[model samples]
Target: MPPALTSGWSRVLQGERVLGEADSILKFVPYSDCKQGCSGMLYVTNFKLAFLTADRSSYDNTGKRNRSKILGDDDIPLTNIDSIYTVSLSGKRKKMTVDSKMPTTETLEVHCKDMRIVKYGFKFAPKDQNKKFVNTLIHHAFAKKDTLLFAYEYGRSNELKDRELICDCPMFDTIIDWEDELQRCKANKTWRVADVNMSFDMSQSLPRYFVVPTALMNNDIQKAASHFSDRRIPIWCYTHINGNSLLRMSAQDSDTDQPREVSRMLDAVKVASNQRNKPKIVKVEEKCPSCQEVQESFVKLRKICMSDTMQEFSNQDAVWNTSLENTRWLLLVSRCLAACNEVAEEVTGGKRTVVIQERTGWDLSCLVSSVSQVLLDPHYRTLAGFQGLVQKEWVRMGHPFQRYLSLVTVSEADTEQVPIFLLFLDCIWQLLIQYPAAFEFTETYLTTIWDSAYIGLFDTFLFNNDHQRYHFSRNEGKNIKQFKLPSVWKWDFQLGSEDFSFFKNPLYLITHDEELVSSLNELQVLSIQGMFCRSSRNNSFTTSLEQNRNHSQDARPERIDPLKKDLLVPNCSSLSIRLWTQCYLRWQSPAQILSGGTPTQYLQQCVMVEEIAQLHHKLKTLQLRESLFVEFRSKNDLIVSHQPNKSKISELLNSTALSSSFPFSPGPALKEKQFSFTPICSYIRNSSLDYDKYVDDDWTGTL
Candidate 1:
């Protein structure tokens, strides 16, 4: 029966050899809330844990023959796993830990970093097969030593030898990339690149090369390092054209008094930023919400978003506002935005340099610094610039990725695993919604990055710092000539150009610096209202554009000058914060709409815009050809009956197909398909659109 459950080794990466494989494994249905189980083949590789159903015919009907199913939605990256458990027949779950004894249970459950839970039953397997498989999975997935990570093994492999190495944006791995970024921001005027930590002897967490105040000496940096946690010294993040700079550093060591060297370093940074005033230090622990608060709020919010049954969702929907408010997620988001705005105001309006500090300087420190730059700098709003910003602030600066987004099982008491990166992305999404054209990237880009963090394919989000990545590769993986790890910025390997096109904002427009600074006063007012009021006037920049488009047949988004400075700062009011449905609710059937909801509408608009652009290009080419033909005809006495018609071309520009198919209305034939398992690491789209027909990519699945 069921073709004897074929081996799932074909679902793994080229270099990822299977360590263990078991047939007749039953996967508990995720969509059914773990009520039913289906027989499948379970495979554990160095990279991931994959489960392929015995009956794959229904899914294979998609007709993708050549595409490599290296990693499927049913697979979970070993590094993305959060916790593991042994499930008893009596419905009792015993949490698995590094030191805990392995149970001879027939069923097991895995919890992931992305708030997903998957269960599997090991019934009908050979004697001791379950124990052998469990031991292997735990040893590989929860590698105690950094050198044991699959990154070292995969990095040393020849899988990528023949693939073209191309990246759309800078990986920021080299010194030259940092230099270029400093030059682009004009921070070089006051800051200079420091390489005191070249061998990671000074600070293991901080990058080898980073920018610091020109006035600060190497010895001063050394002395200052002792005062802060993780030795993450005050370093340049971004610079304002007004000579005000943004800096980040870890909080002072507990139970210690402020030292003289720390004072000297702060003075140097202040003088470098502005000769007149001292730098405004924003203590994240004091000003913003705590990591514990964020973690608790997200737990409640996720429970609401991932409701198991239709009745459960309906009940939650009846008092959705109250339930959401109880979670304090929006409240936390509002507080975070308010804190960022204060820093923005100090840097821009107050004309003072700002230094953001938090415990260990990785969590809240990274969040506020990045969000402030988004408010003050237009460059960071662009896709490439934002990638560089994350590289500089989060990855290079060391955000404890392994600790926060852990590979191994986490204990109930562990609070280190916080969603700081996701929170930062959420803040960026709010800004994107308030000012759509201001960003070169879409919300999809942010969501994609969130998914990429847990994928484990890229080493970008693998280690806690550069020190670990460097030493681990050098000590364990000596096969590769260069110990270079793959960066997520090289996205061409993961997705096609057409899929990549979705990340680019079709309505993107660059605004003048004067226009960016012009709305400061208005922003100050909105910032105050956002903190106190439940509801504020809907001053969305896109509102007028939408209304104008509704009135006229061919009305483009108006480029309103000054952008209403108030719009530059997001409305942090609870009512203003919309749920990121494309991310959190994408898996829930009850939460999903028939035509794929707002995200699909947005994607459809992006498609329409690209089509219109292509048509315009074709029309221009035709006109150029016609002009050349006429010139040749005049000289050679050649004549043709067919002539390019300008009027007809104009008529073609007004085609009905170019109209916005927004709020994505579907036909009667487009019915919702019930999925047996929850899809992960896949972009969900409107099933009715038949998007795969053109793209033919399996990763981009239908809803």
Candidate 2:
């Protein structure tokens, strides 16, 4: 028979006291040993006492016992007696040489009433067979009511070697179930009701012994409770560590009689679970460029998702064709940006022009395109990627629409318009910082075209629609009322140039008010000069009075007092002289150097020469000028030399006279004496006026 089955017999024999002797009698043996008849054996017998006299030999100086006390026969009464039998034997034998010549020892049996061989075994097999011993012990313990305790010495079972001696010798039985629940509780270091029940009930001796499976002990309290109730076992649930009762019941109790305390305990567990299961909230800091606002706050994810307004705005289908929530979100963003702009404006004032452009939606292709040309540099590419990530994250959260709309509305509604403008300004600033030369080139191109063209167009539109005029009648024509129109000077015409003759003959000098003209001139000069210097120098310069120059025929000519110059060159064609003088100053090397010319100077000079060449060519094409003649006579002797005067003068100077005479003018001639000579006398005399010398010296006699 198996050791487990035999152990059960021992358990019945010992009954309630089985636990006391369990440690000694139940020795586990291996299955392999049982097959070989090498299994361990158990001895059981009725109690018998005996005493008998025996002779002893005296020992001499060795101080050693010559003979030990022999068995003495005596009679003793036995209070209890039980049947003795070989319950079980199983185990293997260790390797050893058998000698047939040596006498084999016989198994001995001693009679002891009230003694029993409840179980006995030897673990002589390989290490793997130890589980069988544990199984036998468990079987024995569970078989009989008196099985209070079970124990295996330190070296018995390899599997149970490190584990604590499992003592099921409880005063009462406790039920537990739910395999995973126990594991969870154990992992969390939590103590549940099963632990309480075992600790409380087992401390008492009412039932003497309790049998529980290790699996049951580890189960969840709730599951254990159901299992226990189904089995109709009285259970006293208690906490693991303190043994405090969570619930208590008798096997016969109705469901209504279930412990109220159990409900409380369950509730407590739920509370703990709720806390453990809760989602965490985190705070985020977002900076909106459009509204220039930084938002630092905490938001619950669920709340943000569930907001009706947000939902409405974010909805794809809406009458407004835009998500109202998105619009509001954008508005909020705009508000933030506006706030930021307010701060910026407070610091920078309205001197700076700001414009902000917000990109929206997942189609980063556009943003990528817009910034692609800009992101040629690795650094700009990195920045763009980072900003793109930020934008993408916002979009993922469904707030992209909100942010975009907020930026737009706030930008638009901005009375000062700083926030809206500042966004673009900052972007430009960033772009310039990232790619200075590229930004500069791009700005130059834009200024060359749009600044003038679009700005002019806007100005025209603004001026034409300056005022909103409406007429009202009181009492049906009893009285007519008129109000000044609303005017918005969108473009400052004062800053425009009259030379841009593409439009109506260039309304030069508009608004006859002298102060206004002066102001306008200053403004126009500033715009032109500022833009020109910036473009040419590739640097920014401040606009101020000190930086301006006075020039009569430059783009912005100095205001001339027409009366003053008329006296000096009365018939010199004042306009022509002024224009010629301006050209001369521009062409002079020293003046050009003083003006800080560069290789570009030659280019500018070439451009001027080209213009003059074109003008000359045009004049020639129109046949505007024909040859004019000037006649001169020698005041020297008229010796009747019939020289063809023109040919003679032409021969005298080799035609240089003809070429130089027409182009030059004679100034007021020096005072000269006239001489009269008789026609009959061929007299030769020196002329007082030296016309040849004068003509030769002064290319233009005006000099």
Candidate 3:
């Protein structure tokens, strides 16, 4: 390779071997954004597809070099590529699929899982080099073999040892982790941790150790597990304070076989819990939105999100409301939320054990089970608890991440490609919006997790099951280098300590309140009544909210103490289910504001909240001291007296909130010490101030 092909800016990671390189590759920007193309050198490595410009400049939408040098805007992990299409630069520029014949093309369009569209033109390159580049990309990028993935190679390397330390998430990777979780939830009395799947002989999908009802013997478990698909037995996911527990399992493999053994398993679960009522078997396939339906809705939504031109976006915008409805994404959200609420009610109020049953017990099962826990158990609402919940419910339960995420090309049909996890995140976002103070984590945390899913380095979301992960790491011979795969829970690897601080919700308080339950009942009374169905007459997302509200007005439940009640259900009505614009539309330059967007607003709020907390602490200290005199003319005077110094606020924000990565950065720091304190003081004064004009001059900008 010549010096021209060698990259000065982009460096390959340890164990990341470059297979092919092509120079004079023209990296094309969207015509709506920029007309000119930049010449670059493209390299296809085992780990990633890296593109380095000759000038070594990778700019953001703001025309600033804001991206990191190692994995800049043009560099995409091979695992992130969703699909690839080819276009001719010579003639009509018709896009065609990359088939076995290796079609001659001048431009290659790469669509990524992260919603990034990167186009590279080969018009100036030699035909042979172009063909080689295309071949290398297709062969390695879409390789079905698990060993070919970077996780194994990188795990075997020395670099990962240092990188692994930054992750702070409790991986829930050991049997002890599950035991600890069960004890935390007070579930150890009814459930016992078993290593029935120790060698994966019982089930390939299930983790080695999991909790099962203590009443059942190993023989009974083995007999019962044989009946269900992938041996996804009714395992304990969560247990409420009321003693009713949440369980998840797959439907029986043969419908005609009369699932007598499975019934016995359920009986054992009920017997162990000593509940008078029978367990509620929620057929998730029947109760919630189907994976196929979720996939269809996501595809339509993605097409709308990836609009290439202003004209195309406008065309979609004309019927944007209808388009969103047609996608049925919100409808699916409503259904999932409704299902969670139903399960939560059963487990908490009715004291009935709820068993979530699906075909494979991973996709919808994980979604419903996880969401219900977040709603019913206040522990899961905390940041650490939420991570553990995901680890146990989703990762340990074995949601087919490789297939659902489209990490690698499975088949031509793209059969299992669905955003089930994304849908779960969106549903959580809706809850976070409705009850902002309830969750310990911010929306930025959820979005960051979604973004990290495609990074291809984490072992957390790489495999379909513990079996696959085990096999991938297991080296039979001494000659083979053992692969080290770290958990995605170690978030420090993806974000710095300063950036990670943004994940903590400033609004969250340590004390429980009655408002949560009161709001839940209020929202439930106003919620739409029906589950989402695909009939033409029944498909309108918002049609039932008004009718339901009127009918349920007289049936509103009396508010109770939140300490006694505890659970907080969301208003999952169609109108309440919102599009997560911060996650989906963050990339569109037209959608972004002049200053920082919601993240900046959040930063300002965070700073003010911190100041208020300090003030409260001071007041408590003053009370303890029995101060002789205190100055207070009016509420306004009191607030004004304690208003945070502008310089202090600026310095505080710059050091913390403003240091986050793109899409989350709070923009530039406040330069002027004499800046207006109106926005910061608005919350204290209860002012209905319009800060839009002050925040951004271009307030009329839109996508």
What TM-score would each prediction reach against the true structure? 0.77, 0.14, 0.79
How many clashes show up per model? 1, 43, 1
Best model number under TM-score: 3
C-alpha positional error of residue 181 in candidate 2 after TM-score superposition, expressed in Å: 76
Candidate structures ordered by lDDT, highest first: 3, 1, 2
lDDT tens digits, residues 1-703, model 1?
A: 1222223323434456778877788887645655576777787878888777777531462322211234455677887776688876576779776667777767887776666667788866665678778777876777665556676676666346424444556656677877888888777777888888998889998889988999987888998998898888888888877788889988888878878888888899988886567788899988778888988888888778755446777898899988888988878888899899888878777757888988778788889998888887777888788988888888888887766765433444542367888889999998887766577787768887887787766767887888877766575445546544567877766654434545766445212222222232234356764342123222232342342232222323364323223225668887788777667765554555543455444544444333333333344456666454322210100000111232332222121111111111111111224422212112222322232222222212232
**Candidate 2 lDDT tens digits, 1-703:** 2233223212112112211111112221111222222132222211111111111111121211111011111111111111112222332212111111211111111212111111233233333333333333223322121111111110111132212222212111222322232332232233323443332232221111222222234333333344222221222111111111111221322444546533443343333222222111110112332222312110111122221122433452244323233223333333333333332232122222111112221122112222222222222222223223222222211122212222112222311112221222223333432222222122212112221221111111111111100101021233423211111121112122211111110011112223323444554587865464345321211121212222112323245332221111111121211111111112111122221222122222222222223333344434533534322322111111212242332232221111111101111112211212111111111222222332222122232
Q: Which structure among the candidates has the greatest lDDT? A: 3
Q: What's the residue-level lDDT of 551 in candidate 1?
A: 22
Question: Which residue pairs overlap in candidate 1's backbone?
Answer: 519-565
On TM-score, who's better, 2 or 3?
A: 3
Model 3 scores worst on lDDT over the 10 consecutive residues at 633-642
lDDT of 1 at 231: 89
Give the Å error, residue 538, model 2.
16
TM-score, predicted candidate 1 vs. hidden true structure: 0.77
State model 2's lDDT. Answer: 0.22
Which of the two candidates, 1 or 3, achieves a greater lDDT against the reference? Answer: 3
